[model samples]
Target: MRLPCIGILTISDRASQGHYEDKGGPAVETSLRAILAMPFEALRRCVPDERPVIEAALSSLCDNDGCCLVVTTGGTGPAPRDVTPEATEAVCDRMLPGFGELMRMESLKQVPTAILSRQTAGLRGRSLIVNLPGKPSAIDLCLKAVFPAIPYCLDLIGAARLETDPAICPAFRPGK
Candidate 1:
């Protein structure tokens, strides 16, 4: 089987400038390592919360790097610098709002402030791009909620095939 390519992007001004360490990107990588049993490679990047930069990074990952799935952390809040969703939309051909909605709903069960999260997912070519919260805890919660559908979505987009260990995180497919 071919190994899938996953892109991890951290959008934080402080983290990008080396003023602080990036916990979100590592959190995402850890989560994927725990759940994804299929062979995969990660392409990681850290950039400031700039729309153009985010868009360019996403474009490069999808168009040039040939990543099947790109998960971005940070810049999904209501803050002024939060432009990850906008950049995702600008690069994607279609938007998958249910992923964000489910993430927010799941997060709301843990914290009421989840309503303020603007997390979203979109499709750029064959790649499925998802915007996640910066906080490591929130990232864990959000990823657990939406990840079940990610492999199937990637399959539908002709990206790559992924199989999960049912004992760990069973992926749901209609006929399975």
Candidate 2:
């Protein structure tokens, strides 16, 4: 059987330029390590906040690399350059707004500025793409809030089956 594969794309001009570290990507990786019960690989990419570039990377990860899931960090704010969600929407076949709703709702508990976040999730073919906040702390919180449903979402979309560590995050599979 093939091990499940996912992509982690970090969107940040400074990080892409090497002026800053890509903590958000690693934070996602760490959460995956803690939450997943099976083996998987995370293909990482760092790029500036360019819509075309983000779309291309997301496409390449899902279509070319055959990644069943792609999680993006950053570029979800209201700034003019924050376009990850738009890029995601453009490339996805269907949009799942509940992911963003739950993320913002969970994030709002930590900081009021979570309202400014526009992170969203969508399905591109068989791959699932999710936009997340850039902050490392917020990434963990958002993942915790939304990941319980990811495996089932993947199942519904015909993506790879991802089992979660019940001790860390028990995936909800109805009638399982």
Candidate 3:
């Protein structure tokens, strides 16, 4: 069987231009590896903070690459360049705010500034796109907080089945 594809998109000007190393993309991949037991390919991309570029990348990942899940890092802040959420919303058919709400609620326990985070998740075609903060530490924290529901969400969206390690992320499915 072919391995399922998961999109790992890092949105940053410096990272895309090679001025700075891209840590967010790798951080998301590591977190996903820890949680997912099933084999999959990480279809990674690094784009600048431009909204149109971000939207094109997201659209390509879902509509062309057949990625079941697209997880974006960075550009979800209050800054003017933080347009990841806007790009995500534009490409998504349905928005899932609960993911962001839960992530923020959990992140708030670790840091008082969690309220500043604008993380969110949505569906584009059959792919589920989740926006996360730029910080590496925050990426794992947010993923851990929201990953349990990911597999079930994928199932609902008709994406590739994602099995998780019970110790790492015990995915919740009805009647399991």
Candidate 4:
């Protein structure tokens, strides 16, 4: 049995240039550690806020690296350079808007700025790509909001099997 591979891509111009620390990527890794019940490897990448770079990274992670899931941090806000969602939509076969809806809805409870978040998720071949907010804390909140359905989404897309710790996040796979 192969252990699952999760892609953690951080999109930030300053972070990519070493001008700022990449806290969002580490935050995702921490959440994965707490939520995942089984062993898995995280394939990490950091790139500037460029759509082409983001697109290429997504393709490489899903098609070449054999990653079943790719979670991107940053470039989901209303800023001029925020284009992660667009890059994601371009490469994905189908868009799952509910993930964004749930994330924004959950985030709204914590801050009014959640409405400004344009986070989204989509299916790229067998891989599931999720766009998360740049803020480290928001990443945790958004993941908590949508992660329960992630395993089942992966199942539906024929990706790798991912089991979550019941105490941390009880994944719902319907009738399981």
Q: Put down candidate 1 lDDT per residue, 49-126, tens digits, no spaces.
A: 999999999999999999999999999999998999999999999999999999999999999999999999999999
The 10-residue segment with the lowest total lDDT in model 1: 161-170
If both were scored by TM-score, which would come out higher, candidate 1 or candidate 3? Answer: 3
Residue pairs with colliding backbones in model 4 are: none
Model 3, 1-176: lDDT tens digits are: 87999999999999999999999999999999999997899999999999999999999999999999999999998999999999999999999999999999988999999999898999988999999999999999999889999999999989999999999988999998
Model 1: residues with Cα > 4 Å off, grouped in runs = none
Estimate the overall C-alpha local distance difference test score of candidate 3: 0.95
Which 10-residue window of candidate 2 scores lowest in summed lDDT? Answer: 1-10
Greater-lDDT candidate between 1 and 4: 4
What are the lDDT scores of the predictions, listed in order?
0.92, 0.95, 0.95, 0.95
lDDT of 2 by residue, 1-176 (tens): 87888999999999999999999999999988899999998899999999999999999999999999999999999999999999999999999999999999999998999999999999999999999999999999999889999999999989999999998899999999
TM-score of each: 0.97, 0.98, 0.99, 0.98
